[model samples]
Target: MDLNQMLSEIEGGNDEEIERLLQRYNSENNRTFTFDQKEESLRIKLCQSTLAVLRREVPFSCQRTCLETLRIMSRDKCVLSPVATREGILTLSLSQNGLQEDNLSEEEERVVVEALKCLCNVMFNSPTAQQICVDVQLAPVLCGKLHSADTWHHEVGLFTLRLLFLLSALRPDLRMCLRKDCQAVTLLTKMLEHTLDINWWLTFTAENNERVMEALKALFNLTLNEPEGEEDVRQCRVIVSLLRHVLMLKTETVEKTEELHSHAVNLLNNLPVSCLDGAGRPACASASENLKVKPEIGNTMRNKLVRLMTHVDWGFDIMSGCEEEPRPNPSEDMTEEQKEYEAEKLFKIITELTRHDMIRPMVVRPDGQLGSLEDKLREIANDDDEANNSDSD
Candidate 1:
């Protein structure tokens, strides 16, 4: 049956029609499921029917189907206006009581996950929905959900982290609220450590990797453009340490490993220089060695020096080898422009690393089998000069 017919039947209290429609929609390729602007009335009717189904006591399967359908429909901005209303947001946002309880059945959990996914799409595509989220104080509620141990589930935590990231990214006021008021930094860092299994041992399963990546993205958003206070610095230290572990994790493929590292590096770039003492330490040895040594400024600076030098060396290797051995897969290769951009980011980071007293020696070390930071910087400068000369010619 067509969506119009199914939705009409749904409004007539035939919940089974919604499930059939949902199955049909799910079977079709999602890319083909566009909600055209011309179909505004149909979209509105569909939204009303779904929300109505959610408001009434229906089978959990029916509710989930309605929510899942809405989640797909909300991807289109044209359909979002009707779905972004206060009533719509409230109906879709999982009930605080339901989320708080640990004994929820699998069917009930599926409904909650679908609801959160729907909210994510709504918040992502509509400013109206974002403001409504704030008006309803959704950020604190999400934080509270994460804060409670009972409410934790893999899918629930992942989507919740995603929603929190969107709120922090889209709204400036909520960043501080998430940071100071919600204590999101500490909470997210703990989540990352848990996913990484940092305390017990490193565990790099796909599920945990995805959760850690979302937590990292959210952390990057939360810390963006915010000045670090003493408390913030302390929290950042713990995060950087966890991120160090993230860097060392070997995923199933080289590309996946690089992707994870890229996220880790982006977050590291935002952190304060003081907090980066944790970043420079050897990822594998950090947990044990940290327990053995009392942290001092000298040791911290030395670690930073070694870490910066390591980055410089790694950057040099990539730059030198890019031409000698072209990657077999053209799609996987970094473009020259992208390589240059990454090089610029590295230069900026290395430059910042040099501001400390201990980092100076590493930068100026003489070129040899173990190349120095100065040599890498000089090589990068010569390459830039050659590129500029060629462009001018």
Candidate 2:
């Protein structure tokens, strides 16, 4: 029950006991327990001790509980820096000491997953931890997980990426490393393109949605302001693949469709404005003869985006008559503020896409179904000018 007694048991106890002790402090029902400052300090000490054991070769069960305890401890910002430094974040990052996918037991795999999650939790808001992540070259280790054929690995990779995105935003140097040194954009593209099967839509889970959303969001952060970063993504022909994926979402049942849509569209907004050829000239949208996106594919990409922009129910119709209760619209669950922000992101994407000479006319031409976005803009400008003129009088 006391801190020293708890540590003794954890250092010498069996897995069940260890897990029970950890859960006792971490249980959601024990909300009042979190307010005890002394107990919180004890929790940090326990986390440090657990991580110390985690660094060595231990029973797989013990390793898991260690990770689980750390995962819970990491939720407290007060403990994060100490855990990051004392627990050896950098050491755990090395491939030799870290978790791997090859020849893993199911239990071992779960342990690896928990370890990754624990790291994510510690690094979530701690600048020191985030710096250590970059200094230790953690991105490559996480990238390896992204390339694994196992879905669990993919899930872990994305979970880690979400943390890295936050770190990179606060540290430009880390962002550069992730983009240029770690090649995050390229690795994320591969993960995003990992298709399950022809019947993949049916098998998709919340895990899949989270993975793809994080991947897109990470790429968006990496490429947001760096021209070279954006160029690297453009060279990967991200627009073509991203557009196709968005189109496929119509038939899919994802838990966070709005997040996926928002991220995908934001990434599209981040892509290089002009996809050019090697000759230093504007590449024809219809010709993929020399570019990463093929000619025919380009048109299909545009059409798909247009369809999404125009029709909200294009893909949901097929799910209308299902035997089970209809899946709730994720949009309805969103806060009013969040919904407004998401709508702004969509509007920005539509605005940016129409800037291309090829797309502008089609999207805003008179007689279009959505009416002219250009006309709307001009009308707003006129209203503003008239207001200014009247104010002068």
What TM-score fits each model? 0.68, 0.61
The lDDT for every candidate, in the order shown, is 0.73, 0.62
Give me the overall lDDT of model 1.
Answer: 0.73
Q: Stretches of candidate 2 above 4 Å error?
A: 1-4, 11-20, 23-34, 91-97, 149-154, 196-204, 229-236, 251-255, 276-393
Task: Indicate the TM-score of model 2.
Answer: 0.61
Per-residue lDDT of candidate 1, residues 1-393 (tens digit): 366776666666466766777667655625655656776678667777778777887788888887877877887788787778998888887532355446777887888888889888989889999999999889988887766533467788778888988998888788988888899888888777666774335436666667777889999998886466778878888888887777667776656766777788788888878677635535454553432222222335344333333333332343231114344964358988988888899888877878664455344435333556677888999999999999999
- Window of ten residues with lowest summed lDDT in model 1: 290-299
Model 2: weakest 10-residue lDDT segment is 314-323
What lDDT, from 0 to 1, does candidate 2 have?
Answer: 0.62
